[model samples]
Target: MTTAPFEFFELHVLRATRISPGFARVTLGGAGLGRLASGGRDQRIKLFLPRPGQQEVAVPVGAGTEWWPAWQRMDADERAVMRTYTIREQRRAPDELDIDFALHGDTGPACSWALTARPGDPATVLGPVEEDNGGVDFRPPTDADSVLVCGDATALPAVAGILAALPPGMPARVWIDVEHAADRQELPTKADAEITWLCRDVPPGPGGPRGATVDGQPAGAKHPMLEAMRAAAVPGGAPYAWLAGEAGCVKALRRHLVNDRGVDRRRVTFTGYWRRGTSEDDLIRQAIAAAA
Candidate 1:
């Protein structure tokens, strides 16, 4: 079941559905699910997927502190594939976990598995057992007067979760980047938030889209997410910002908010979901190096 902060649960696929042009929703349910608790708002979990030709994912469950080292020592072709993802939603009564996968058309192992995952497909997830665990990252101070959120398709689930959890009527400025306009989905929020969806597929002619300018350059920049944030007028007086998505883009957004917009560095929460050009295998290699 649960061991204070984190624990492992043997899970299986209940269903997999393509909800958008670039997203897939996979529901998981199994034993010990009753002990799994989600901290909501950008809850993170490590999903263990089986390697090709394997029936079930192989991981050292309940290894606790030794989980990482033990996993590293396992045969690469036999061990489970580990990937980080945000909890889209968690339900009870029947006890089910929902995870949204950003489909990359087979580039990512998780994405590839999700595309063809069948009901009863075995998997494992290392998740939190308590409500106040450290996995949830969207933490806004009590004194924050406004909120700013920016992300691409990879961060959509976390962004949506943050918006949904925000206090009623809290002013929020949100910008979401997607590859296609059809990828936009309904994000329900009670906050006084202005949400902007930028589709890179749509060309922003000449001067820029909507006549906006980024750092004296055309507003319709190559990476519209960064350009839009740089040009937008944010509210003053104790604002907290949350940024995620591409590594370079998140870095630039954080820099813009802190150095250029005067937002306190401590108040901003930023995470890089992925790098622009790096493959998933590259990340695996990097993780192995770091662990070593």
Candidate 2:
């Protein structure tokens, strides 16, 4: 099979609806989307959203090795805002995709855009042009006896997609952290999984952030997800672990699994979907520095 080069496509909001207190699902469809086949559950894509007051995203063509440098050189007013999001669902006949955004009001650009996004809002996406794109991150070995999955509200869509993709009656354990009860939603899955919802002490409201803290954690504390994860028993027999959400929690969970729980680091797949109080540019710089 030949690999397809990642390319950008212009899309528009077919619809936008509030799914839960913390999530809003946006459906996007446009031309040049037929090649986007559903390959895996944790599929990642980049969304180039219009900046404030802009009607459409104006991104440069030929986004390759030089794309970033050129983009950085562009005037700040002309550059579009880019964000990473997971594909919540895909429909082939209509060639449309669903993405769930954690709406935190005016806190972040993506959240702000999603909160006000209406039908026909123009956007751009960078994704694979083939079904078997390698960007899918949740790869569990076939022989693994059980599975462990955990994340905060930001990862709910990916976790649900992954659970639905699991083989029938596979044993799994899932832990999800949210800021309030309203943030919880029905996670339909065929896998035999025990799901624990960790609700933080803070109540979610119009201005509050979801998954900003863990249950019983004091204000301004760290590793609430790690503490919650530690309290639960890992599934038995060569279990594969998939972790996501905040970068600090990802690191803490990885550390616990590898250093304390005796799980092989090789069996764990983790990604820092976002970091608290950091921008996407900061994350890109951090990745570059780590690679260096």
Candidate 3:
């Protein structure tokens, strides 16, 4: 059976505020939000921007396979460039709302736009749909065993969101990698989750940094993140593990957790949020192509 493509929402920034030194929260609202799926974590969305002086233009929405033709028809400069981002938070009441964007020195369009965003800015928004895991919602087993969650800055919001949403007294251990010590923020959660933040002084490598091991070893050296994760004892049993970040690092961590640690493949979820030398749009294109 074929699933119908989801609809897009034409929204405008109702407000934009800087939450941290390198993060911005933009709130969007419009009638189109009626189609958004509630509480979609780590879902990607499109934000259609108007060229310097253009008023309005048509932007493609819905599934990639069916939307490509309309997108192709537009002039290169006029077509909207889509970027994937996790839905940090959402509010469906008095209309609709979303918060996201990480400020990374203007390396990409989304970051560039977010750094300078203001109230009333026009940006067509779409989606709050299931992402890489195919809509699977795997929570840590209550009576079973241990839990491990690992990710970098791009995956922070989702990790944080998951942490905050966990049921009280749930046992899990989480590891997060960020650009600097200052980038570390409190992740409030009711679950009995132990979180460790890995901060690197060195700029992110070819791929975003997954952080050097505590002993100053290279990222791939013994799979630093995975090693740290392994050292921490899983209380319940063999814990369900989640790993997400740069393609290479995520793949390696996934391998270490499942192959070396003997974690069941079905109990682990790994995602390559981004790749080295590629923009979010490129990643989206690659995913769409692979899906096709």
Candidate 4:
């Protein structure tokens, strides 16, 4: 099987359907999809949005250092905006995949585009690349007795994916916080996983806005989802935890799980899927900076 550069992949929207009050499922089709690995639950892919009236977008083929010059040489109007999204579901036989977009108003490029996406629309698929460990490694070599997966609306697809892929009877717990009660959807999983949803009925909290409460208390004040997780007494033992969502919430959960609960750092995978008040590009930059 030959794998091409992420940028070489073409964009073809096969179908789009409303999955829920706040989510739209867009199915895309292309050749060689089966060859591309099915990114496990919570895995992300970058989408390159085409400019108006443009049929294709050029993607650099190699390292940033080798690709920057070519990227800079392109006209400003021809450049496509990049956004990250989760692989909600994938089917190989038909070479099709579905990505669920959270319809949280028109605040960003990808959200805005997805709001109006229709069949036959165009989009550039960027990555289904391997993780840092190389290839798919769902079972990490760790001694933890349980697993905790946490995230907000942005992380739901990943949470659902992880749940569906877990080995039958594996012990895990999932915590999800979304903008509203209607955002909750059925998760398919055979693992001994308990999922709790924390609904924030108010509009999304403004980025950088401190002291905003989800209900009558601060957003973190016994966040319903976290409280439920903490209260659950897994008789087996402490488990490795995976946390993702807005940068602040993820960071806070990491601190709570590690500093407060004394979870071993090696067993935890925490990611900031997005930031409250920053552009997707800025969020990526921030993540890179933090890792650096």
On TM-score, the candidate that comes out on top is 1
| 1 versus 2: better lDDT goes to | 1
Worst 10 residues of 2 by lDDT: 212-221
In model 2, state the lDDT of residue 75.
73
Q: Candidate 4, which segments miss by more than 4 Å at Cα?
A: 1-7, 52-55, 61-73, 129-139, 202-231, 284-292
Model 4 lDDT per residue over 122-240, tens place: 77666654443222223444566667888777878888888987778878877777766677899999888876666666444646122222432234444545555555554355577
Q: Write the per-residue lDDT of candidate 2 for residues 204-240, one digit (tens) a residue.
A: 4455444333333222236556766776777677989
lDDT of 1 by residue, 146-251 (tens): 9999988889999889998999999998988876666788899999998888775555556565423222233344666778888788975899999999898899
TM-score of each predicted structure versus truth: 0.92, 0.85, 0.79, 0.80
Q: Which of the two, 1 or 3, has more TM-score? A: 1
Candidate 1 has what TM-score?
A: 0.92
Backbone atom clashes (below 3 Å) for every candidate: 0, 0, 4, 2
By TM-score, is 1 or 2 better? 1
